[model samples]
Target: MRIVAAFLLLTVFAGLAIFLTFTSSWGSLLIPQAAANEAAVAVEEPTPMPDWEGKFVVETNQPVVLRTDPFVAAQAAGLLRKGEKVALKGCDVSGLWCQTEAGEWFVSYMVGTLPEGLPVLEGVKVQAAPTVAPLVPTADPAALMPTATPAAASVLLMLPTPTPAPTVLPQAIVADAANLRAGPGTSYAIVGSANFGESLSLAGRTDNGEWFQTDGGAWIAGFLLSDPPAGLPVVEPPAE
Candidate 1:
């Protein structure tokens, strides 16, 4: 009888211990799991630039000149204030002149430190000089006539090729939707894209006239554009 009584007492104690273990707050078990799940999800924030301005600008007290082309010989397109904001399209390989979204070129420098890399073009020329006409000698009209001497007869006359007149403004209509490439040929990689019927300003053309460079320094096939304005300065093709 004593042995049975002891066994019953032990069994009652074991049951009580189990009941105490499980009866604590039910939320204690689920709360940690929910907290762990929330911790696993991460929220990212954008990195902040302390000195970054929304747009690029020249660091000077005077107004900055905007040119029609990248070269110094190009006429002034307009002017921008020293603190005026200007958007950048891209820069030439040399990174000297940066093209603006407005299709004009400007010198690339800022008041703040320059970013690690400027958007330098891979296949582009910094300057494109136009062919100049031969100068006429300042002499009498009779002196200009060819003489009977053998040396005078042998001198080859160089005639200047007339640049064709553009029927329209220095712009073109896109015939089809396509990307503007980096080079003159179709094999080149695309730098930007053009939509069908979109009008783009023309900067220049390849020497053979097979490619046309838009004002933004991107190249487009000559055939893709609708009758690009003539007399454009022949630009140098990108290296192979």
Candidate 2:
């Protein structure tokens, strides 16, 4: 009878021990899960940004310098060729400036006229300069007198080989105050004044870098380094 009573007591103690072990395990798991849920609620996720990429055409065919700051004289960044295409990542809403992928700012006024449609990631076509035609034989009435001799008639029959006219080159404007004189020298009388970025036909220049003119025309010159003035559209020469 004593042995039976001892076995019953041991069995009850074992049952109690198992119950306590299960309860402790359940509590530990619940606490960790609750803590994890709280941490998840406290942390917030960051929002994603938009991706905008496109090619833009320069509206004006003017020389534009890229700047580090919005205002001029901040820092010498770079120069943009006229009628060049730029890949725009983003821009300032003021419409006064645009930023390149390299983090350079360029003024809006210096752009050549952009194409009517916008293109993405592909080739952005731009206007190119026209090619001049080859010079042909032209009759000079002053030189063309009726030949009396057979040799002269034969020469005239050769169609009076036309002489090529001197080719005219594009002129550079004075970006600053420049003096127009009888010759390419400061000592030459200042017949006219050239203001900033004034367009003048280049006659020729002295070896010392002084510019001259073939035609006796006056222009404005200056010392200021600025992009072409705003509001002037790119002028396309008439087609041949």
Candidate 3:
């Protein structure tokens, strides 16, 4: 009888363990309620949309290049005029590049939203604005104006004029190991290697305007360098 009682107790416990293993309530109890709610929230959330409207107008501070890809090293597909308009297709996650309906890509920051009041498809016509004539003071009004004394004029002239800051020409710095060639095109022989952050003075640009020549007499692909610094003058390339 004692052995039978011990065996019955063992069987009861085994059945209870098997029941809990298959029970949904047992699994739910194992997971915190907060965790389950958080997971449901994650599944229901949607991705945020891009900031751009359907159309974008090129309003760059400087001319921007349209590229085959979103990266700077991509081939120069074309140039987007400063005020040209383009249809927005999509943008990269970084929001730095936008692809156009024509399948070309450009920097997104260079574009601005099309003004709501402007016509979307109309060609812009620029007309010379009528000039307004300057108003001249009458003799009576001119008499009331104070004239500068010769002594005051001399004092103003003696004041030292501030010296203007010298213009700093744009320099190209290598972002990675890059080949410096004898000419802008890759067909030219490589003359040296430019290490990361190596600075080179601007010399000139290729006829196609795709490559830059350094003062060091080495040519680097313009796309390989960071965005050409503002105010960098474009020089004519040397005769090939």
Candidate 4:
């Protein structure tokens, strides 16, 4: 009986020794050198980007390649799908390239910007506007005004035009039921609506004249209206 009990005690000690040998520093000797070295190293963190300047959405129909640099020839870091929202750092004044918070760049035209109803950017490279001829011959604007006599000037100061004709802005009718968007394009958020035949007070137009900006700072497509009065003031689209 004493010899059997000693054998059981020896088995228990041997098992414990085997477990400790595998679980302790001694186990490293049996491990592959490369894996052991990798386990010893800490992962390096990525460098941080600057605070976001604004947010934008991917506007392209296909996946847009995120370039390492602003140029199209730059190495591609990754891809962004259409309509993917991204927070940007900033864009160049020329509006060619925009950088993201992830340290990647995308082409300016491939991203959603101001609404579609807004006029095309003047200097920015966008869809090429068809060439429009000069509607009227250029003349000295100052020479066109009639020279007022002293008596007429005095009367004008006393009683400005009895009507608000001077204050009245250019107006357009909603020939078709169209949406009034916050920006110039259909891609912009809809803020209001113009019923059929509703009259809209016009404030400005985009450079390409494809959109008309309302007095309330909303945008509607130029094609959505009847003939707009000539000499509508050309204005820039509001930043979204």
**Residue pair clashes in candidate 3:** none
Model 1 pairs whose backbones collide: none
Quote the positional error of residue 99 for candidate 3 in Å. 10
CA RMSD per model (angstroms): 17.3, 19.5, 17.2, 17.5
lDDT of 2 by residue, 105-223 (tens): 66544464433443222232221222234446666755666655875776667775556577554455554454565544333465776666666654332231213343453222111
Please, what is the whole-model Cα lDDT of each candidate in the order they appear? 0.65, 0.50, 0.62, 0.65
Worst 10 residues of 2 by lDDT: 219-228
- Model 1: what TM-score? 0.31
Model 4, 1-240: lDDT tens per residue? 999999999999999998997788666765677676777675656789644343443345434567676543345587677666666666655565666767786666555653323222243333333344455644655565567798699765665443322557778877656678888765789899888789999987777666788989899876556566556667777777
Tens digit of lDDT per residue, candidate 1, span 1-240?
999999999999999998888876666888998888787765545787445365543343334557777654456677766556555666787675677768887555422333454567567665543443344445554555555466654453443434544434287887656568888765678788998799998878777555788878889865455555667877787875
TM-score for each candidate, following the candidate numbering: 0.31, 0.27, 0.32, 0.34
Q: Residue-wise lDDT of candidate 3 within 191-233, one digit each (tens)?
A: 9988867787775665434567777777876655765443333
Q: Count the backbone clashes (under 3 Å) in each candidate.
A: 0, 18, 0, 7
True-structure lDDT of candidate 1: 0.65
Off by over 4 Å in 3: 1-168
